[model samples]
Target: MKVEGVLVLDKPKDLSSTEAVEKIKRLLRVRKAGHGGTLDPFATGVLPICLGRATKIAQFILEGDKVYQGTFELGIITDTYDLTGEVVERRPVPELSAEEIQEVMQGFVGEIEQVPPPYSAAKYRGQPLYRWARKGVKVEKEPKRVEVLEFRVLAVELPRVEFEVYCSKGTYVRSLVHEVGLRLGCGATLVALRRLRKGPFTLEEALTLEEVERLQAEGRLEEKILSVEEALSFIPAITVSREMARRIRQGRPFSVSVLGSLVRLQKVARRPRVPWLRILSEDGDLVAVTYYPERFSGEGWAEMLRVFVS
Candidate 1:
């Protein structure tokens, strides 16, 4: 039996996200499997793995916000910003009041420039930064703009601080920890980290790899799978009639009036913004995904970015 859905794996620490995917592929005996996002081997938590046809929706999950709870050890800095690298620097941490620490953290709550960690997967030229770092080579890296929607220091212990972060895609928690330390006048390094949420999936809903293996042994793996449509719940969905669905399946576009009607109805019904639609057959097989730019002109209409089934 071929399985098509998302698997929210509770990744164990010390296993790269890719390694976890490989285990899932082997367990399920599926030819295709992809993780929504990559997690550092030292970090663990909710890692969504998509299998078979569900891989088509992996991009949607990757584009969503992520939440993490972790601790940063103060007074020491590592080359990788985490426990994986050697301490490159150490500084004396001055006695700071709770209010002062809170004030310093506030500065990181919005848009800011962040430099990728030297021991990271970021590419310079054609080689990964980690490869260069391993060779003791230094390369100039451009800073990237990343938003920190929420950054709160949950607990403060002299040399260790626990915090929760909610941020946009591509925001690196390791880099954030290093920068937060810079703001506090002391160096810092990530000692432990765990992702609590990724888009609509939460740690509460994730399963450990051991549990997945047990289920697979019992021949009940599919029972734990989440449908592709369910995994893409974060995106706006527009349901079409059977005729329109057929046209979409035939590689033809739908009428402009149909899209206008949806927009008008959504406005009157006070529905959440439906900027995009999921074209589905009457029996519920996903055909294509599309967006509207004013009028869904059939001449250059909603092009199918991904066509799942004919």
Candidate 2:
């Protein structure tokens, strides 16, 4: 059987996220495959690879928050923030109390301005920043607002410190490390990093590329393929009658009165209460994802972001 769904790959270090997806494509012999989030070549951990129809939901996965555990070495700053780049500067480690470090970390919490690293994939004037960096060109970049939900120093060992961060999408941990080092009055560079979680997926549930290959060779690859519905379990669900499902498939809006209870309950639940809804056919097959805005007028309707038929 053809396999389709998200595969949480425990990306190995030294392999770019793209390379890992390529390996999965080659292993599964699937022409369509994409990763939800990008991991630097030197960074490793939970990289979600979507195969076949699962690629349609990759954007939603990418929009979710990510958690990472990494170690940053102080007294040295690198061009790439991580060890992949050469050290461009070095400074003496300033004497700082643990309490001081914690206080500085607190400042990073909530919404804050973050500047993307120069040697990054961020674009400038329709060109990748890395492209300019490789050509010995420096471009001034504007700082973007990124939320840092959690920033805790897990351990401190003189020049090397381990930290765990839970941040919004697009928050660069490499730039974070560099900024934190500057806050401590000492330069720093990311020495090692591993993503522990992304949205609903965690490292504990991830399978390595080697294990996936083993499964494929044994003709058990389907066992690892989660259904698209299972992958989108985080979204709220709304089961539609067969007639309503047909109407949806025909691109017609259904009566909102049927979901009256859901709307009322969601009003009390307030914002960020899974605004998206999973519309399922009477037979329990997923049809599409619908978005109902706040104070949703009965005239407003939910559009299908993804449609799945089993």
Candidate 3:
């Protein structure tokens, strides 16, 4: 009864990501568990909880893009950039056309720099900035670069705007909405947010906590778990002989020349920064994850990233 796979949880509001993971672990009686990404306690939806061996791939999943749908209240500013924080200011909402709002959102549809909110988990001087803020200390952090693939305004109702966004990892939706209000001349604060997708996991594939409990009690919890191989299916795989697999599991680096006909050596004009490959055994068991470069020749060696124990 080894539990090793991913469970997509439709996280409920008011529960921290770590709390959600703890709850899943308790319900499933799993010894090893981790989460792919962190969602604010107030935000709900697609939170991937990795069980057993699946925890090894949680970092890769965390790097994937995310999509969120949320609402922002215009003419209201909060210290935390969301409704969870205290109101800092309030102004009259100016009349604006939907087209004008769309134009402003479109301006953020690319790589942009953003400063994280003061009341956030971002650390300053080895302590969370929120801690300093709560002590009446102000901490101004340097801006960070994040990509925003899409920012669409779903609807506009005077002071409230409903929108959806597709963005790179670490792109704060609350900050994005606050910046939009800044550009519009009236401040705004996030009212509500729901994650639609994170990496390959989606809200449609997620289960509620109660459903998880019911399924576990019925011995059907495994039905919802995504296998480790399935979770990393996006990466290219190379099947090797048992000897090669054994060597990989032992963390022995094998030369590219040994792969020979099994690997199609190619040269690329540009190499990916950190391309990954799944090293599988003859029986299709994932033996290891390795750094396989595209520009490698017969002399290049595959760098082992993680060696599977079982």
Clash count in backbone of candidate 3: 0
RMSD of each: 2.7, 2.3, 2.9
Measured by TM-score, how close is model 1 to the native structure? 0.91
Worst 10 residues of 2 by lDDT: 265-274
- Residue ranges of candidate 1 with Cα displaced over 4 Å: 254-258, 266-276, 292-300
Measured by TM-score, how close is model 2 to the native structure?
Answer: 0.92
Best candidate, TM-score-wise?
2
Candidate 1 per-residue lDDT over residues 54-122, each given as its tens digit: 898887778767899999888999889998888889999988766777788888899888888888888
Candidate 2, clashing residue pairs? none
Best by lDDT: 3
- lDDT of candidate 2 over 1-310, digit per residue (tens): 5778999999998998888999999888899999989888888899988999999999788888899999988899889888889989999987766677778877899999888899888899999898999999998899999999889988888788888999988999999988888888888899999999987788987899888989888998787777788888887676667887787777776555555555565443333624667777768888887665565556644556666554
What's model 1's overall lDDT? 0.82
Error of 3 at 223 (Å): 1.3
TM agreement with the true structure for every prediction: 0.91, 0.92, 0.91
